[model samples]
Target: MAFKEGFVWGTATASYQIEGAVHEGGRGESVWDEFCRMKGKITDGDNGDFACDSYHRYSEDVQLMKQIGIKAYRFSISWSRILPNGTGEINMEGVNYYNNLINELIENGIEPYVTLFHWDYPMELQYKGGWLNSESPYWFENYAAICSRLFSDRVKYWVTSNESQCYIGFGYGTGWHAPGLELPINQVVRAWHHNLKGLGLAAKAIRQNAKGEVKVGLVSCGEVGIPASDSEADLQAARNVLFDRERSEDSIDFGFGDLFEPAIKGEYPKSLIPYLPKGWQEDMKDICVPLDYIGINVYIGSIVEACEDKKYRNLKLPVGIGKTSMEWSFKPETLYWVTRFISERYNLPVYITENGMANNDWVSTDGKINDTQREDYMNQYLSALSKSIDDGADVRGYFYWSLLDNFEWAYGYAKRFGLVYVDYSNYSRKLKQSALRYKRIIETNGEILI
Candidate 1:
């Protein structure tokens, strides 16, 4: 299949993951920067103090993109790095860093897709309860305003946030990430309310300031959970794969379900409020703002069975598929069904913002990285993706999960997800076998005959 006239082929990365220099150029610390210092938080006592030195190595990375023949690159801006206090003073040096990156991409004939927030919030904001504060909308709007004024001319596409459900729920509610606080069900709803509100306000700000075709949407991780067996327990578990909890008389699912339907349907998933916080109904209107395109981040899939739970009489979710480095399953079909479901239900264009796997890689003695596993993974996933588009899924773009190896959040440098490998010890980058294969696909316009 030849690439469509307007189809996009790109790679993506986040600032915190790639660009180290946490303290350079007046860059204020983020919640993750603080979180990593906590005892027993990150694996193996690792942190991202100097992950890739991409902060100072932006030009080199841009050259790598040029060599890779990537049409566009999606990368995130570090909030704390741009605005030291998370609001007031603009760090000219930090601003110059990202500005140079955008200019470099343009010089190399590559478009820059900017993601505003990518799970790395400023420590100042976290101190004030961050997304928990209703004022977060204004704070985010302020930040958006600054970013637009700075680079809107160069940044053609804008993704407001990475994944609110994961960032907010996992970071604040589940105690898995920075500013980690294990709050109860009620507080989780509050965080969601604030996050959705922040997105709407931030989108409005971006639209007002952007000079390009502004596309705004949050990234969402998707999975089509299937049951391993035909047992009634397994079947029922597959029906409701999300994490549901009954805090009050209201029963709600936290992990995934109905939460995203509102973003596309312009309404909450039918009476999903009693499970939310007080005045949560008022937020429905705010979260229903129209978006140009929605991005789905698909890594792997799941299948589960209803195991005995002390609380819910009947509850089970997709579990145990031999796991990835991130403990995710290897179900590429889930990505296909998920894309189909959203495009059919909402009739909106879908862009796969992030889709790749992390592996413990080793370079063979012949100086070749035998990523046959990744090749198989890519072939199946892209085949399903192409089929979804062929079935009229309104899919527009597909970006690999990352451009270069970088910090893996709490996992530190343990997991590598890049088609191009980065030598963290020396900041030397190499195009892995996967990168070469991807380049060939792009070269032939994705029309390779199998």
Candidate 2:
């Protein structure tokens, strides 16, 4: 069956990943700028200094989206670009840059879904303890208010933040991302709590200062636990694993429940209540705000089965299973199971905010990039997503992980996850074979999938 009518088909990109000219726009330094400077931190010593040069060529990028027939475009705003020091005076040039981008998308009939934060925290703010500071929520709220007042007239959809688990767990717990710091579990939880508080306050600020009607949501990413079989025991086990909280002080199991529960359910999981900060109960008032929808970024999942010793265990994939260039498992069923579980638990309309695979793509002798792997990958995953919708999940939209081949964070520019291939040599754009197929899918509102 085809996806439901009015389902949104789109592509996503982040500020730091796509927008270069980081210094030319009066943009203040971000934690990522500093992280890339650390010895051996990034692959090939590659940084986003000239990533796709989207800051100067966004109009051309918009044309590419228009040609691809996408209905929406999900992109993040660089916080440092707007408030150079993360807070204080506004940077009008950054504001104008986004205003132009938004107008360009609308002029071409593409909806803009703005994500307020996507881990590009200002370096100035990082020096002030970043999310560890108790006043961090207010800081985020102020930034959100500025965004709402400036762009809400044209942009109707807003996301408070994208993937808190990564920014907290990977950034602090593992020191893998920006503002790298290998903090202990207790501190990580503290930062996570403040992040959630920021999500709530940002949501409130957006709605309060919005120029018109707006829909606010948060984008979260985590491991999905799919059942091995349709049996009741297996299903229960998968659900248990998906929602399980950290069981001990040393455990770093940052699952969907940790971030989602507080924002949507208004309380921490029972197992996590003891580890919460002293004023957490009072913080709940700001932590739990009503959201218009929930956005999930799914790339892979593991099969879960019931066990005698524990509620559930994730079974390792076979040695030769299909995998992405990033080595992530190629489990198409991840979309189905993740969308179904999230909808049933939260009872909110869901959006596949980010879903795509990375491939080692290059221009062939035919002068075109034939990324058949990504094309097949999208077919399998979208088919599973359609099945989830038919099974009564409120799956509303799907956005490919990226719109252009950009700087892939810690991996640097080595990994490519874009439907539109970009030649780094001279910053040229070419739509891959999969992009053409995606254009057809969008033109047919996914009827081509059937």
TM-score per prediction, in order, is 0.89, 0.98
lDDT digits (tens) for residues 1-450 of candidate 2: 577789999999999999999898889999999999998889999899889999999999999999999899999999999999999999999999999999999999999999999989999999999999998999999999999999999999999999998899889888889888998877888898999999999999999999999999988888888999999999988887667632667666677878888889886877777667788889999999999998999986989898888878878788899999999999999899988989999999899999999999999999989999999999999999999999989989999988999999999999999999999999999999999999988988888884
TM-score, cand. 1 vs. native: 0.89
Q: In candidate 1, what are the lDDT values of residues 255-312, reduced to their tens digit? A: 3444556665655543346546677667767677788887878764555556676212
Candidate 2 matches the true fold with a TM-score of 0.98
| Model 2 worst lDDT window (10 residues) | 244-253
- Per-residue error (Å), model 2, residue 183: 0.4
Count of backbone collisions within predicted model 2: 0
Q: Cα deviation of 448 in candidate 1 (Å)?
A: 1.9
